[model samples]
Target: MTTTELINQIRKKKSFLCIGLDVDLNKIPQHLLKEEDPIFAFNKAIIDATHHLCVAYKPNTAFYEAYGLKGWKALEKTIKYLNEKYPEIFTIADAKRGDIGNTSTMYAQAFFEDLAFDSVTVAPYMGKDSVEPFLAFKNKHTILLALTSNAGAFDFQTKTVEGKELYKQVLDTSKTWENAENLMYVVGATKAEYLAEIRNIIPDSFLLVPGVGAQGGNLQDVCKYGMSENVGLLINSSRGIIYASSGEDFAAAAASKAEALQKEMAVELG
Candidate 1:
C-alpha cells in the first residue's frame, strides 16, 4: 500500500494501530492445537476479530520460521487470507532481513512479490547497498531499523559516531538512497524523548513503533514527540492484545484490547 492509502485507512478507522501477529503456539489457546494449522487459526481469529480497529497487521517472521515448513505455510495462509479478505488493510512482514545486495533482492522478492506484503522491516547494519534492493520495489516499503526499543539499542544506536548518534546518521544517510521516499523507520516507543530530534531529521517518514503495552512504553509520551502532522506512527501491541486471554474467548478478548488502544488513538488524532 502507498503512504496515502495507509493514511486514509488510519483516518477512516480512527486508528493507526498495527497489530503484531507474533503468534506463539505455547501461549495460544490449547484448543486451537487441535486445528491443522494452529498458528494461522489463531492469527485468523485475531485478524477477523480486530481488523476493523487497526490499519495494519505485522507477522514477525521468526514465529513462522521456528516451526519450519509447517509454520511457514501457516504464515502464507494468514497473509493470503488478509489479502483476499481485507485488501485495504496494510500488511507488514516484520522480518528484519538484511544481507549482501543480491541476497537482499531475493529477500525483498520473497516478502514483496511472493508473499505480497506491503512492507518489510530490514536491518541497516550493512549500509545502502544491502537496503537499496528492497527500496527498489515501487509502493513497497523498507522499514529500516533506527532507534529500537530494546535495552541493547544503546550498544550502537545511541553512541556518537562522527559527532552524531548512529541512529540519527542512519536516518540521514538513508534519505539519499534511490526511492528513499518509500522508506519508513522502526523507532522504539521507549525512546520517545529522542523522537523530536528524529523528526527534525526525517520530518515526515512513517515510524513503525513497538515497545508499548507489554514492554511498558508510555503511549502519551510517544505521541507527544513522535507524532507527525499525518499521524505517522504505527504503534504496535503484540502480547498485550493477542495474548489477552488463553481461553476460548481469545479472539473477543483481543478485540477488547484493540478497541481500547483504538479509542486512545482516536483521541490522539482529534
Candidate 2:
C-alpha cells in the first residue's frame, strides 16, 4: 500500500494500530493444536476477530520459520487469507533480513513478489547495498531498523560513530539511497525520546513502532515526539492483544484488546 492509502486507512478506521501476529504454538489455546494447521488456524481466528479494529497485521517471519516447512506453509496460508480477504489492510513481513546485495534481492523477491507483503523489516547494519535491493520493488516498502526498543539497543545504536550516534547516521545516510522515498523505518516506541531528532532527519517517513503494549512503551509519549503531520506511525501490539485470553474466547478477547487500543489511538488521532 502507498503512504496515502495507509494514512487513509488510519483515518477511516480512526486507528493507527498494527496487530503483530507473532503466534507461538506453546501459548495458543490448546484446542487449536488438533487443527490441520494450528498456526494458521490461530492466525485466522485472530485476524477474523480483530481485523476491523486495526489497520495492519505483521507476522514476524521467525515465528513461522521456527516450525520448518509446515510453519512456512502456515505463514503462506495466513498471508494469502489476508490478501484475498482484506486487501485494504496492510501486511508486514517482519523478517529483519539483510545480507549481501544478491542475497538481499532474493529475500526481497521472496517477501515482496512471492508472498506479496506490503512491507518487510530489514536490518540496516550491512549498509545501503544490503537495503537498496529491497527498495527496488515497486510499491513495496523496506522498513529499516533504527533505534530499537530492546534493552540492548543502547549498547550499539546510541554509541557515537565519528561525531553522531549510529542510529542517526543510519537514518541520514539512508535518505541518500536510491528509491529512498519508499523507505519506512523501525523505531521502537521505548526509544521515543530519540524520535524528535529522528523526525527532524526524516520528517515525512512512516515509522513501524513496536514495544508499545507488551514492552511498556507509552503511546502518549510516542505520539508526542514521533507523530508527523501525516500521523506517520504504525504502533504494534502483539502478545498483549492476541494472547489476551488463552481460553475458548481467545479471538473475542483478542478483539477486545485491539478495540481498546484502537479507541486510545482514535483519541490520539483526534
Candidate 3:
C-alpha cells in the first residue's frame, strides 16, 4: 500500500496500531493445535476479531521459519487472507533481512512480489547497496532498522561513528538512495527520548515502533516526541496482545487488548 493509502486507513480507523503476529506454538492456545493449520487458524481468528481496531498487521518472519515448511505455508496463507479480505490494512513482513545486493533483490522479491507484503523490515548494517535493492520496488516499503529498543542497541546504533550517532548517520545517508520516498524506519518506542532528534533528520518519514506494552514503552511519550504531521507511527504490540489468553476466548481477548490501545491511539491522534 502507498503512504497515502496507509495514512487514510489510520484516519478512518482512528489508529496507527500495528499488531505483531509473532505466533509461537508454545504460547498459543493448545486447542488450536487440533486444527488442520493451527498457525493460520490462530492468525485468522485474531484478524477477524481485531481488524477494525488497528490499521496494520506485521508477522515477523522468524516465527514462521522456526516451524519449517508448515510454518512457512501458514504465513503464506495468513498474508493471502489479509490481502484478499482486508486489503486496506497495511501488511509488514518483519524479516530484518539484509545481504549482498543480488541476495537482497531476491529477498525483496520474496516478500514484495511472491508473498505480497506491503513492507518488509531490513537491517542497514550492510549500508546502501544492501538496502537500495528493497527500496527499488514500487510502492513496497523498506523499513530500515534505526534506533531499536533492545538493550544491546547501544552497542552500535547509538555509538558515535565519526561525530554523529550511527543511527542518525543511517537516516541521513539513506535519503540519497534511489526511491527513498518508499523508506520507513524502525524506531523502538522504548527510545522515545531520542525520537525528537531522529525526527529532525527525517521529519516526514514513517516509523514502525515496536517496544510498547510488553516492552514498557509509553504511548504518550512516543507520541509527544515522534509524531509527524501525518501521525507517522505504527506502534506494535506482540506478546502482550496475542497472548492475552491461552484459552478458547483468545481471539476475543486479543480484541479487547487491541481496542484498549486503539482508544488510547484515538486520543493521541486528537
lDDT of every predicted structure (CA atoms): 0.96, 0.95, 0.96
Instruction: Tell me the spans in candidate 1 whose CA falls farther than 4 Å from its real position.
Output: none
Superposed model 2: Cα runs more than 4 Å off: none
The estimated TM-scores of all candidates read: 0.99, 0.99, 0.99
**Which residues of candidate 3, in runs, are more than 4 Å off?**
none
Clashes of each: 0, 0, 0
After superposing all C-alphas onto the true structure, candidate 3 shows an RMSD in angstroms of: 0.6
TM-score for candidate 3, please give it. 0.99
**Using alpha carbons, what is the TM-score of model 2?**
0.99
lDDT of 1 by residue, 102-206 (tens): 999999999999999999999999999999999999999999999999999999999999999999999999999999999999999988899999999998999
Q: Give a tens-digit lDDT track for model 2, residues 196-260.
A: 99999999899999999789899999999999999999999999999999999999999999999
Candidate 1 lowest-lDDT run of ten: 213-222
Compared with the true structure, what per-residue lDDT tens digits does model 3 show for residues 1-270?
899999999999999999999999999999999999999999999999999999999999999999999999999999999999999989999999999999999999999999999999999999999999999999999999999989999999999988999999999999999999999999999999999999999999999999998999999999999999999999999998999999999999999999999999999999
Residue 128 error, candidate 2, Å: 0.9
